[model samples]
Target: MKKIILSISFIFTFVICFAAIVADLTGTWKGLIKFGDQKLELTYKLKAEGEKLTGSIVSSYGEIPLTDGKIAGSDFSYKIDIGGGPQESKGKFMGDSIQITSTFGGNSVTNTFKRVAEK
Candidate 1:
């Protein structure tokens, strides 16, 4: 029926638009986290292929590989083990800002990331 066809078209369009928004996370993000006065600068570089995200974190320690990254809508979750134990992060995107909550070493730290400006 006409109504059914229209409904499917609308759903498809919405899904494509949402996927584009999720893909926008691909690139470099920089943020600083403070742990009791010890502040560290971190950079995240992400790549999107379909709903899977591949990226790495760069800090003073070096580059840390991100594992099992996946995205749905505007939310994403990934894991990495650095220094201590396995760290898990859940991130949400708002405009040009990314808010992430990372948990590791029995503590959780939340940081805001801004997209790196391109030359």
Candidate 2:
């Protein structure tokens, strides 16, 4: 009986830690993406349901809808269709920041987003 109780406690602790890591990323984030001399401000609103993520991006140019976003462990992948063109980006989410790398128009760019306090 004691052995069973200890095993259950260990399993419960592991499950809680996993859920916390996943939930750490579900929120609204804002940042900037710079490519050469051009820069754009971006807002990302993310909703995570289980392992699936759905969100939208708003920028100075326009709003792009995100679809089929998913998170596996600490990595995230998502696709966005903007103005009839599809672009995909993948990155890792660190505690207060996310490092994203993508290619647009054959040019590769890296963007890092820092979390801002909600007002």
Q: Tell me, by TM-score, which candidate is best.
A: 1
lDDT of 1 by residue, 1-119 (tens): 99999999999999889978877888899999899979999999988777888899999989999999988878888989876767789999776989999887668888999999867
The TM-scores, one per candidate, come to 0.91, 0.84
What value does the lDDT take at residue 68 in candidate 2? 74
Please report the candidate that would top lDDT against the real structure.
1
For candidate 2, lDDT tens digit of each residue in 18-64? 67767877777788887679888988877766688788888877877
Find the 10 residues in a row with the least total lDDT in model 2. Answer: 110-119
* Model 2 segments more than 4 A misplaced: 1-6
What's the number of clashes in each of the models? 0, 0
lDDT of each: 0.88, 0.80
Model 2: how far residue 64 lies from native, Å: 0.9
Candidate 1 residue pairs in clash (backbone atoms < 3 Å): none
